[model samples]
Target: MSAMTGELAMCGASVETLFEESVEPVVELVLGGQSARVALFGATVISWRTGARDRLWMSSLSARDGSAPIRGGVPIAFPQFADQGPLTLHGFARTARWRLADRKANLDGTLVEARFVLARSAIADTQGWVGDFELRYTVRLGVRRLELELQVANLGSAPFDFTACLHTYLLLDDVRNVTLHGLSGLEYFDKVAGRDRDEVNDAIRVEAASHSSGDVLGQRAEGFVDRIYRAGGERSPLTLQHAASGETYSIAQSGFPDTIVFNPWVAGKKGTKGPDFDDDGYNHMICVEPAITREGSGPIRVSPGSTWAGTQTIQVL
Candidate 1:
């Protein structure tokens, strides 16, 4: 119920009360010309707009009543990524409700930040995850950029291992015209191919199937792509460029050792483009996730009373 507003700068945080009865309150952060919306249902950032354009992609068919996980935007995968563990797919974090701990704007109206918290008790009983844990997620909105940080604290008496990922869906003018850089010279686990492979190209491009008969080796066909690149905890940033509009984005992550690139173009063998996702949703969005996971190596371990943190920053260029 705490809300603040300003005039000239138009900077502040406010909860959208209209949906209070259907879903958790959504906190909207505004600073200057930039704005972002975070739904407390999953502590998910559903929208981030800068330069009058939305940088984050959200599915039109996504659930807004809190009955299920929102299909797009930045979904937090905690305690488990996908079906890697005994828990449900992507764990219960994305469907669990979170609390809005705090929100504030900078005195100068140049930045706004909001924090959300989730405890183990909020998880569903069917998830069966009994770890005493607490998750803190912070979203900061600034000029032409958005920052997302996640911290997981083990509050139990014993050590625990888990996998986490900030599943970010970047909105694009066209996925076929985008090229991603910084994954070259790295090894990755190709989920689609079900094998481990090495990335040889410095710039990866996604091309439509009709562009060529899959002649290019490194070029990704306009089909399903699911690969996890081993980042080795590198602090370098990945660059995504849209050839049509010349718009670019710099993606940087810290404390996350892996990056996942995914797109489910034209419902094929994977059948991932379900009812929650539109038929052409994959054409305009690409998921570039920062994760703390190792395919066969196992999950990250945290000792009792310890905390693990990871952050992802997206800047418009």
Candidate 2:
């Protein structure tokens, strides 16, 4: 939505033309008949409110700018390591420009499919950190379903080793009210335990007791959460099912090794002012992320002239 560009168009019933104008890019989405807004910088679908009658699928913050800004929902970084790589937070892929690859009709033309492709820059000699990789993102919407796919290919001459992930912050009516399915038996790190090891004795229940301690400890234990697991043993289409609305979000990934869950209810995380971040500040959004590393530690090793591919699809049920 760069202002320098021009106007945008509304292709629905209005079939109206509008300027694609905004300081930051903005994209409107109609999925499963849901009204969702995605940002240009993150390519993230932030607020998903179905038919204006249903509650927002995620939360938002009251920005000083007058936008009922969805605070904590959306996909985070890509092509960068977290806590481990020299690259900045979440990596550089989020802010880069992507092109519309294709558009086709479905749902008897009631729905549309748009594909976007991201490739390495033409000036690779200057940009050192970013890998020579191509990412294919496809977004589709129907009257009752929404689907998104991310496919990546390594294009460097040398096999590269790197960690990767799709970080999604999902809005929830209440975090404590929901139970995430499909991750019961897998081993997970109880971030509340810090550097310590603890068994998940509580049967991985939805409202299983939650805790936090100290400033650092409390940030994790109290009202906040971060968890990671290996995806080697799970079924292909992992799911995060919301019981109340009977809405199921399924995530399928290939060529990746891990998944992470994080919810920051405190200030820095809530993007608030102080330390005790109100976990539900914007609303209750949970992140079900798939990655090749946990917190950016173990990177996928690549050999020169070798190409690797990773994919994740989000489909509604």
Candidate 3:
């Protein structure tokens, strides 16, 4: 591990690298009363704190020794999403070690930025996928907002098609007390039911009943939920509001055409939890992911020497 630290004399913003004995290095960014932690193992933002509260939820059983993918925070899904392709689940970017390309703070120190790079060589195996590629991930932290941008550049001579996403887990007072706005009138593919359906309500609430019944307006979400909403070329921001705390988060994405909402309400047959998730974890966290692939739509193609990028910005409102 490199013994390095960056400081800004103008303000309270600073970037420091901490090394653990066996695990990868972790980068900490602090500005004013807000802070964020990034682990190089997957270039994953494991923690983000603002207003003295943690807005990102992390699973208590998540592995910290780079043994497995961290269960929470903003995990980068690249080259493939889930079992959509022949590659591993969510691709290898979430588990592969990333290189810290750069880190710095602005002149006033009100914002901090860090860049991580992953090349084709870093990936041990690409599952027979051809095409040399490089990924650049940038994280910007402000007092009340966090921005994540992913750039995929094709360096090979041939064009390649792939899918990607920013899997973000948001912590909430209670998943049932929250309503997600801005997905109204759109169509979504429900993974749990393996069907396509239309969203009728302007505000989407967690419901225990199946949404296929057309009467999911006021119900609470209790069962396992996994749906991908198509938002092609739409720039409208989605808002997640916690009823108990009055805390609202505005989630917006660019270059990512789909949004996936997921929650494992009941883990197993009897609501038993998985190894990396708590029995009650579903009650406190929800994932509103920004993705680049749509149902029945194929992967995105990038020409030689061309680059594809996506940005997801979350703000406290």
Candidate 4:
């Protein structure tokens, strides 16, 4: 419930120390009956557990858990999918282990910055994608904000291409109780349906949509919401406010062209265990993804050596 105060860690087993000792920073954040463990050095949010309920986050979508073993939560994809050749699913960025490059703190102790770096390598088994790449991720935790900045560098002889996003799953008291503002007008695609390819719609607000789970827990917002928006807002940040706690978390992104929103109301979308809608697992988490490609369901190609960047900030109010 409380931090260990002005110390390098919260407890002897602080999240920071967890990484230094084990060569992996796995910190568990448990709040409102939800639990998630994130590895700072790994730059991955590994596991998410809700009380005695069950695990909703999937490390694998198919028969295997994936060659690059990421525990779950949020992952960063760089130089994206190279026409789906060697790398499948997202790409090589998340699967490879990044180096701990930087760490900084605010004068008031309200904010913290830590960075992860991924360089080009001839590892051979790295999904066959080659390019000198640098991915820098920063975490800023202030009194009111927690933000992430991803700075990428393509240092190869050729330009590298890819679509990227911070695949973050925000846990909510109830998905129905949450409202996503800032995106009302844009173009998006419906993944659930085979037809209606990338269509344009007037700005749609979250509150206006019907929650309509119509089941035991009432948390099914049926459909696949993966699209790209020309986020032309002056704020450049998307806000998510929870009515019950009066807590507002802002999901901000800049330079990224697409925002993918998905709520798996089905039993399972891609063969992963669907959160027990009966107990409210999937309904409690919302993924407001900032992506680089608006062209959904297709491979985002990167040339030989071009770099791209994006960021996401979370401010709790």
TM-score ranking from best candidate downward: 3, 1, 2, 4
Q: Top TM-score: which candidate number?
A: 3
Candidate 2 residue-wise lDDT, 1-317, digit = tens: 33211111233411111235433454555533554454544455445455444323344332212132223444545666455566655665555555555555442435555566767772223235746677667655555445556666677775656666666666666666666666656666656456533324332333323443546554434555666676632545666667677777666666666777666545335543333234444236567776776542367765655555555555565
Global CA lDDT of candidate 3, please? 0.82
Cα lDDT for residue 80, model 3?
A: 89
Q: Lowest summed lDDT over 10 consecutive residues: which window, candidate 3?
A: 212-221
Query: Judged by lDDT against the true structure, how good is candidate 1?
Result: 0.79
Output candidate 1 Cα RMSD: 3.8
Residues 231-271 of candidate 1: C-alpha lDDT, one tens digit per residue: 73473599999999898899999988888888867642133
TM-score of each: 0.89, 0.72, 0.91, 0.69
Model 2, C-alpha of 47: deviation from truth (Å): 4.0
Please, what are the lDDT tens digits per residue for candidate 3 over residues 176-269? 8999998888888877677788888787776554344432333333466788888723734899988999988999888888888888675522
Pairs clashing in candidate 3? 206-220, 206-221, 207-220, 207-221
- For every candidate in turn, the CA RMSD to the true structure comes to 3.8, 5.8, 3.7, 7.2
Pull out the clashing pairs in model 1.
none
- Mark the regions of model 1 whose C-alpha exceeds 4 Å error after superposition: 1-24, 208-222, 232-235, 268-271
**Model 4 lDDT tens row, 175-203:** 66777777655445544342233333332
